[model samples]
Target: MSTLNLLRCAPHALKKQPVWVAPSRNIALSSFLRDAPAATASTKVLPGHEYYPGKEEYGTVIGNREIVGHGEIPYYSDSFMVPCPAIRFKEVDEELGKLREKEKGDWKLLTLEEKKTLYRASFNSTLEEVRAPSGDWKRCLGDNAILIGIMFFGLSVIGLSDPEFEPITVTNEWVDAQTEYLIKRRVQPVDGISSWYDYENNKFKPTWSIFTTKETSQSVKTLSERGV
Candidate 1:
């Protein structure tokens, strides 16, 4: 039979003890919990599913490629990404069982309530219900706006109390010192400043580093002292 038909009819047979042909403990547990149920009066758990108290109710059972449910919570979501839920939201009780039998006939013949009843038995919510706005984003945006206001207020207080910031490295003295250091180290001499030097003028006439005679003499003296 098709998986859908099995899903529709399997619950009626779920009360019966499953044929325990599974090889491993893991398989046995999922299959037993999914396939069979405990006696209601005694609250008896099936053999393999009862690892501890109420462990059988953890999730649905799986056996013979069919899942049966017990004491599972109902849930429904309208999502485009996830197409299938692991199990039905509602279990098939006697009323739903009878309706399911009738569901085998022409769906068009079924009354609106009957059709709705059948659908509700399997799911807790519809696409329209899930898609409806809950006004949650308003609260979220309000909270974020309050946080932004607080951040701005704190930043204003800090800026008013704190001393003004200065970037010392951007001053003329610092730049001149850095330029002299670079000249002393003969930075990029082959492909740079020296490559376009006015040797006859005994001066650095390159466009970028217009070094005066005094600064150039100090850099050259530093380079000679450093043996480079």
Candidate 2:
């Protein structure tokens, strides 16, 4: 047999010898070597459409305006004028007139005895004799001296007898007169001008300004031009 025929037919030598083979590219080596999907048009960034920093980049943006911090901005209008009501001096005069008439009527209706009783009560006289004086002595001594004498008698008789006695009767008319007097004293007009005024023209402006000053300031003007 020839040499080539003899090598091909040699089974013992082929089984003992090592075989050398080239690696195939079609076989997968690892899981990382697998093909990835292609990116869509939406994932890609377009040219000249890059992000740019704005003026309010670091602050809060509201209606295209950036606010760094709260500033001193007044929410109210400076030129806004407040409404004031006019003073009605006529009404005050009428009320005062009515009070005066009532006081006169009450005074007229009050008897000499009632007046004397009120006088004694006002001075806080406690002596029963002075409170209800008898004989011509009360008529001659007058109310003032009688009240003084009663006070002196009360002080002298303190340890001898209890000075506590019945209180004098105060009428409803007296109480009403007293209350009206106090209210009138407080609410009476200062220089005859009862209402507030803003000197814009010849007309009188009515405001709720109750404060009155002897002299006018730059912001506040006097109610009366004639000093009432």
Clashing pairs in 1: 34-61
TM-scores, all candidates, are 0.36, 0.11
**Candidate 2 lDDT over residue span 44-97, tens digit each:** 322211111232332232222211112222111111130111111112245444
* lDDT of residue 126 for candidate 2: 26
Off by over 4 Å in 2: 1-162, 166-177, 181-228
Residue-pair clashes per prediction, in order, are 1, 4
Top candidate, metric TM-score: 1
For model 1, the stretches where C-alpha displacement exceeds 4 angstroms are 1-77, 91-111, 129-139, 163-228
TM-score of 1: 0.36
TM-score of 2: 0.11
